[model samples]
Target: MSAPQIVSGLAEIADRYDAVLCDIWGVIHNGRESFRDACVALARFQAERGPVILISNAPRPSPAVIEQLDGLGVQREAYARVVTSGDATRALLAERAPGPAFKLGPDRDDPLYEGTGVTFAPLEEARFIACTGPFDDETEEPNDYRERFEGAVARGLEMICANPDIVVQRGDKLIYCAGALAQLYEILGGKVEMAGKPFRAVYDICLEEAASRTKTPLDRSRVLCIGDGLPTDIRGANAQELDVLFVASGIHEAETLDAGGAIRAEAVESLLRQEGLKANWAMPDLVW
Candidate 1:
């Protein structure tokens, strides 16, 4: 059978799906700010009986996500509830025996270890490493931490990734995430664990949280996972057997139509075909 047609507007697709599992970074907002129209669109959908859950690979818990969203001007009512990989990571850390952890990430990611009782350790004394992103946001590459990563690997310290996205659009620039660092560590023979979409653990948390609020049990068929990233978001949805609404305006902005232009329906179809995964619907972005 031919793949489902790409929908032109988010509202059209929203009406069809009972629940929305949305990615935060590329869909609703960039790292800097939240999309006003997208937030409005989600609020409107919820008002119309559709439940919208903000599922993200943020290296912080739901409260932290909310605080960040609040800083970005996203209202609490815009989403039903928030679920993030950081919550799952915190849970995993809590279950393990307390060990000195070397955090190889940004300061914003520190909240992931909050209340987990995991002791922070210096690179030389760390028992394991928890990577969230580059130490500095201004750096183009992770070269600044090359020595630290190498040393960690040399000492045989295992690493845990809070976010599984390799790169994300921070305004007009693409910056590396924790997944990039984890990938590099693994290449050097250091053990690494990921906590996010396509990894099962994070998705399970999202589904469980969504299930609690939803009046009706979330059916895989009636759900739509909307996101921009192919490897993480689209592939994860496909694996879960849920229909997806691929928003081409975020990470794939260059390949969709043009930089910051509406994603053509045909282009979305072709792109999905190349990836061997079909989105049930497509929109230029979350704009209503």
Candidate 2:
């Protein structure tokens, strides 16, 4: 494929695609607040074009995530529907119900387990591990779990990761996510399972829902996937054979943007190439 063209705004290519699969964090918001322009652009697209479906890796179910989105200033009309890894994970958790699993992650992530029938237990009495992220992402790191993971590995407990993002932008800072712990678990000879981005589970849910909303069969060629995450967003889109619009000013901005704050096409290309990935378009930030 050719190098991505740096786009000034979404309007440049809005007409080329029929629907958009957009990322929530970093694209429309940074955990602390919303990106007004990006939100407006999506609202406009939904008004003039086709459905704008949000595909997020957040550990909370879609309905619960809406509360967070509302607090962050994201409008309800910005998209047709929202699909998340947490939504996809409920099935995996349900299949293993009454597991007495060791539930990890913060209280906010508790919504992910409701009605899944999976009961929680202390590590010593647990049969498996369900991790959404560190109990306190602001203060914990992956290494902090090494001691606990060693014991879990000895028991051969499989960890089900709700979110596959290693890190996410929280305001101006980056914080650890469930995938970070999953990464560490794998290194310690433990098994990990995830159904988030870069995995077909979440995409399948998102696409199926998008198709249902459009009342027409989905066409891969006319769908656009937008996100700032390389491993999750870009890789997942590539696997589904969908085009990508890389958000240069998101989490990877430190490396993809130059001194003058312009998106460096060469740098973006080099970064994606290094990861054996490609995006059809790149923009400093999402705008109308």
Candidate 3:
């Protein structure tokens, strides 16, 4: 009901939360390199607060995500632990064990199936679909999977959408993700199960991990969710009734900023209203 508070850094509201559930891509990194300031902010939060968990919609397991983060120059001290959609999706798979699943992502994401007890099967022989994203996001789009999804739908295969993010910024380019494909399949009357942000599963893992490390029961009201995505990160936090600090310079920057690259505060309010999103505060970038 009130206009979102605009701030310059996390310090402005750092004392309000004991833990931080932070997004990976777009918030801390751009898929190519880590944002030093963002990483520093997380480290600072962990030092002062209870814990900081890097939550992501990446379809790979946490270890795999960590390896990638290390390669991307993300420091180990940035956060206490990482929680990923892949971990939540694997849990879902464990409940439906001993089934042949058709994996619809790149070979690099194979770690998602490491210990899930799911057999890899061809589409025709599979019981369900596990969608991470395209094999090559740089060149593929959701339409590229039209025929594949159509065939799967005809066979009544439900999809497990590992990443609930529709698209993410990769450096300077925007690439489609599993959510876009899942949405397309649903549009064509296919059933989908989501397991990332905007959904509660990943958040549950993050909160649990934070509490375990802190060795204290965490109050949801004392946690802060930091991200740049409206549909996934921001919406998910709002649904869980958690306060959020939104970074407006990521995916929605172009749409929320003036032609001169300044953030249009009124436009931001209108956009949040249109999308039915709520954030306690907003900043162009993460700094502390």
Which candidate tops TM-score?
2
Best by lDDT: 2
Better structure of 2 and 3 per TM-score: 2
Question: What is the Cα root-mean-square deviation between model 2 and the actual structure?
Answer: 0.9
* Candidate order, lDDT descending: 2, 3, 1
TM for every model, in the order presented, reads: 0.91, 0.98, 0.96
Cα RMSD for candidates in order: 2.1, 0.9, 1.3
Tell me the tens digit of each residue's lDDT in model 3 across 50-83: 6989999999889999998999998998899999
Which run of 10 residues does model 3 get worst, by summed lDDT? 255-264
On the 0 to 100 scale, the lDDT of residue 198 in model 3 is 86
Error of 3 at 69 (Å): 1.4
Clashes of each: 0, 0, 0
lDDT of 2 by residue, 1-288 (tens): 579998999999999988899999999999888999999999988888789999999988999888888998899889999999999999999999999999999999999999999999999899999999999999999999999999999999999999999999999999999999999999999999999998999998888777777756778798999999999999999999999999988889999998888999999999999999999999989999
TM-score of 2: 0.98
Evaluated against the true structure, the overall lDDT of model 3 is: 0.89
- The lDDT for every candidate, in the order shown, is 0.80, 0.93, 0.89
- lDDT, candidate 1, 140-192, per-residue tens: 47666667778888988888888888889998889888888888888777888
Positional deviation of residue 154's Cα in model 1 after best superposition, in angstroms = 3.7
